[model samples]
Target: MGQLVNIAAHSFTAQDLLRMERVLLDALEFRVSNVTAFTALHLLVQGLPGTRPPVAALAVYLLELCLLDYTLLEVPPTHQAAAALLLAMHTHGTAGAQAPRLLRLARVEPAALARAAGRLVRIHRDAARPPTEALGALLAPIVSKYSRPSWCHAALCAPLDAVDPAWCSC
Candidate 1:
């Protein structure tokens, strides 16, 4: 079973599966090297059973944004996944007691998660702006795909205006 199939078993729709397939095919066709983050994103979703569909979708969206920013490569994939989940939970108003458990599961400290989430926030903000001429074509397809209802319109969700300082105290 492929990673996408495993992910689909959890909460993804058929359209989501197809989109993932297309991405993988494109990567293979282009001979893109070092695509571990994309695999990590799928693993993250698979690891967290019972995650709500919307939250998972949002997390996926955040991780995809990370793929576009080379600076985010400094963060570990597990940390990125954790941070994306944290931000998604907060965005969807599903965060609370489960936050600590999530951190524990990802083996990520609160501080690290906070820093990663902060970076994601910045990426999300920049993604919302009209893209630069150089990268516009590259970024448009991804943003547009996630904006659709099939993907929970994740890209359409408002970027976090501010991450709560207290949330990191966990």
Candidate 2:
């Protein structure tokens, strides 16, 4: 039988979730090789808040979305991070004219990041759709884990289909 990782394990506490959240934030906001790139994410996400899409959470969700698609793995982490950030901003309907400015600050080309983000969006759309029995079997745990109102705060459950087709209209 396949080994099942029990979510109910005492060792697997909310602290683990907290740590994961911090790690994702760190990865998205500070892990780029260039300090300016990290700073760029910080600047872009700082001011926007309050019942709006959680920028940090969206970035992390997009990262998880990327992980599910093997092709995205081939992209450089910096590019992938940039793409995820852009997708997160777009998903929140906050992208507007900020995409190009942020990309310029990160020293990433807008075209490449847009292509990568498009792929991420497509993957998210596929995953967010109602699943068939086999697909449901695969997605159930992921959905269940992120659906927990207490932990991820449903960040992973937010609708990605809301992403605009232009991705970066700006």
Model 1 lDDT tens row, 32-59: 5564645665666676676788888888
The positional error of residue 83 in candidate 2, measured at the CA in angstroms, is: 1.6
Clashes of each: 0, 0
- lDDT tens digits, residue span 1-170, model 2: 11222545555556676677689989889544544324434555553333244655666565665666678766666666676677766666666666666565555665676677777777666657745677656666666665565434534545565445455434
RMSD of 1: 12.4
lDDT of 1: 0.79
- In order, the Cα lDDT scores of the candidates are 0.79, 0.60
Q: Which stretches of model 2 miss by more than 4 angstroms?
A: 1-53, 130-132, 150-170
Model 1 poorest ten-residue lDDT run: 32-41
Q: Score every model by TM-score.
A: 0.70, 0.56
Model 2 residue 45 CA deviation (Å) reads 5.3
Worst window of 10 by summed lDDT in candidate 2: 1-10
